[model samples]
Target: MTDGVEPGTVRPGGRTARVREAVLRAAEDALTEQGFTGLDLADVARRAQVGKTTVYRRWGTVTGLVADLLQDMAEQSAPRTETGSLLGDLTANARLVQRTLTDPRQGALFKALIAAATGDVKTAAALHRFYDIRVREWAPCVRQAVERGEVPEGTDPHDVIRAVSAPLYYHLLISGGRLDEPTADRAAEAAAMAARAGVFVRVGGKQA
Candidate 1:
């Protein structure tokens, strides 16, 4: 079943693209409103105004549909911000994560997906891939920082990038703390400070 356009890409086509958009949007709505337990293929088709046959034939199962949704999200994620400084770049990333996790629709959708992934291996893999894509998107900025001599040599770019958002996600998923803009800025500050101190340098690479 292939109702989705494809993972890791946005293919160029009209009707197929429209169908993909509608289905993904409907899936987002359903997941936000009712969580994964309420994700039914027929209901999703109805919500999308596409045929039940189309949804069933394309997705085959809820797990597959959810996986496709994560892939679509990764593809549609915002482009990296270039600020010419590690702190600035990390601040941008943290702010993006903060905004996304605090928005009502998006926040709920993510909660549902995370919850679904906790019990489903396929969903978990898809979620991991989604983060991997996002991490890759921002890792370049860390590499640039290294070139600028901001961080130590052999710093794990991905680790530093992930650190910028780690606290925000911790608040979202663990601490139940507020995810405000200040919190985001602080997350960036902490990550940047640690990074500048060589806290994220590869174990065998370099140290402060």
Candidate 2:
């Protein structure tokens, strides 16, 4: 079925956005309370106080719902702030990443999502899309820095952005290291150092 806006809900510049926000929030809450395997559209509809038909009509399946939810989150998440310097931008970005990684609810939700993605191709694709959006959102800071001569001429902004969060994600998903503010700062500094040394610079038009 072709799912569009909910019936009786306005679109573009009005309550439609708010209704979508509420639905997404309910979906996140459902995901937090119950992992991917336990996620239920009925529960989400009940929590959101929206129509079940609307939920199902809008998202054909659980994977589609989760994918839409992740996309909405990426859109709502804060964008990179320009502080006129690479250090400032990287620090701010690192702090944001750390805060999200350390948040109990979000962290647990992510762990569950990772587990689900491990077994489900659809979920894995959705997860990849989420990271892609996040990476694209923050990559511009590194590009701006390059233009300002703060980094090498050939720095890969996307790689630089990904590098900033790689260590933090590794700690959370692998090493079990603490993701504290200090660690966040260290990651930013490390990424900065690497960029300065041309490590982030692309070679042979290929990203490493």
Candidate 3:
């Protein structure tokens, strides 16, 4: 989904754009400090120094605002790294996720969003879309690996990309373990090895 307001409601570098930027940053601050359950449109408007009516007109509900926030984040996410080899590329991807989840603010923000998604359908769908975009961005690296004959034919690029970050999320949200460089490296290495072993290969339109 598109970020912020609907089409033609905001123009680039216009007042509406500025308002969107302020509101989204405020939303981030709220999510970081208070979690999803604490998010309030009036509070966001106060934080953003914008009119409550404006926020309401643009985003409608707390869930709608959050959906837009996720879209904005996806759009602002960094481009995938190209490291010439699948292991190197996957390592870069893993390290990126590690750093984000290890950061004080980002980690809390993601944890809040994830917790929100567990019970909220809109939040869950937004979160899924956010990851889908990110996965697509990195999937090309795996496809390139296939082209280079580094992985078996029919290797699923999306699966390989997801594998690199799965353990990192598990550490962040489940195990509460340290997300150090070694952990990221191990995740990347395992995914690379598994890909080479045909563990991610597709058979009959399904993962084998």
Model 2 lDDT tens row, 1-208: 4257322222224765676778778878878888888888888889999989877766757877777777676777888878888878888999998898788888877887888899999789878988999889888889898998989988999888888899998999999988899999899899988998899888789754
lDDT of 3 by residue, 21-138 (tens): 9999999999999999999999999999999988887787898888888888888988999999999999999999999999998899999999999999988988999999999999
Top model by lDDT, which number?
Answer: 3
Whose TM-score is higher: candidate 1's or candidate 2's?
1
TM-score of each: 0.92, 0.88, 0.94
What is the Cα-based lDDT of residue 81 in candidate 2? 79
Model 2 TM-score, 2 decimals: 0.88
Which of candidates 1 and 3 reaches a greater lDDT?
A: 3
What shift in Å separates residue 49 of candidate 3 from its native position after superposition?
A: 0.4
Task: Name the runs in model 3 displaced over 4 angstroms.
Answer: 1-13
lDDT against the true structure, per candidate, is 0.88, 0.82, 0.92
- Model 2 misplaced stretches (Cα beyond 4 Å): 1-16
Residue 193 of model 3: what lDDT? Answer: 100
RMSD of each: 2.9, 3.3, 2.8
Return the clash pairs for model 2, or none.
Answer: none
Ranking by TM-score: 3, 1, 2
Who wins the TM-score comparison? 3
